[model samples]
Target: MFGRFAQFETREEYLEFLNAGVEFVGARDGEPIGRYNVAPGTRVLLLNQRDDKLHLDPVHWGYQPAWAKESGRPPLINARVETAATGRMFKPLWNTGRALVMADGWYEWKKSPDDAKIKQPYFIYHESKEPIFFAAISRFHPDALDAQEDDGFVIVTAASDKGLVDIHDRRPLVMTREASLEWLSPETTPERAEELAHDCAIPADEFAFHPIGKAVGNIHNNGESIIKRIYNPLV
Candidate 1:
């Protein structure tokens, strides 16, 4: 499962990745951001497409449709790729509501071998130090904010394998710029989106994870130091 992550890059730096092709909402210096510890149920940047133009919108980060609320289901922060395209909870978004969740990295907890009850935290980030674009699906509508409690989204997740399996059995489906652009493009078909989720996920070797202090377990604690390596990863 994926919950906590970081995105401390400047708006212009990130906008450089998407380039001049996209429009920015609240483009006035892009205030109120630079979050190093992003948790669920908070506002975050989402890159989505509408009206043949790309948009970078700050949106709520959880999804709970009216029917879900009436049914007493909690808001969803992550949606599984195994069933997202066909699942009832996400079918509405899989084809038309695809989006990109920008981040520097994410955190995961591993069970301590010495104690099953204890878990150690690790931060996973791209080896290149570039921004990560997590594939996502959303219920966001620029003109329909009232359609749900608030316009929110869910990151698409896939089963983890290779080295990352030791840290967590699942992870967010982080994608490359090319793959991310395709996912957000209106020209992509539902089948292609699903295929992209399965075929374009970044390899575990492309990411580097290292142990970090448990202070990150608390959402209230945040900063660049929060992601500092507790011990040298290479050692």
Candidate 2:
């Protein structure tokens, strides 16, 4: 499951590809700056469809369904694509609440083959170093007695492809601009939505990854330095 990612693009940079007006609503502490290490519940930019048009919006990263809150269950940060459409927690948004979680890259920890307890961190990003979009789903939460709170979204994941299986068992469901638009369109049928979801898994070869320092393990360590590559002889 994906639990950390990086989004270094400025608001203007995201607007270049989004090509839509943005409404900043859920950014933490009202800070709209780019983040180098994003975890669950972190505020991130999301592209959502509304009234036949796409809009850039800020939303919480973790999906906290009302039932989970009532049951005291943990929020979900990643939902498997294979079960997202049928899973009880995710099915509601399968066809109508699709979204795009924008990020430049993501982080995954690889266990050392030689030692079960040893793990190394790697930063994965597009070969071209451009921003990548992860397929996502969003749901609204209630603030009071039937009053609505802001929407929260969860990134979708798929079985790891050839190049990534060695690093982890799952990878984020990535999409191209065309696939993103198709997935986010409310006009898309359930069958077509499933097809689009399967088609958007980014090829592992399209990503470049390298070992990074363990500083990233701490959520408090946030900055460009957190993603800098570091030599790992074991890797």
TM-score of each: 0.91, 0.86
Q: How many backbone clashes does candidate 1 have?
A: 0
Task: State model 2's lDDT.
Answer: 0.79
* Displacement of the residue 168 alpha carbon in candidate 1, Å: 0.4
Pull out the clashing pairs in model 1: none
Which lDDT tens digits does candidate 2 get at residues 36-153?
8888877777777776655666678887777788898877888899999998988987867788877889999999888978888899999999878889898753234552443688
Ten residues in a row with the worst lDDT in model 1?
A: 24-33
After best superposition, candidate 1 residue 164: deviation in angstroms? 0.8
> Which sections of candidate 1 miss by over 4 Å?
20-32, 144-147, 232-235
By summed lDDT, which 10 consecutive residues of candidate 2 come out lowest? 22-31
Pick by TM-score: which candidate is best?
1
Model 1 gets an lDDT of: 0.84
List clashing residue pairs in candidate 2: none
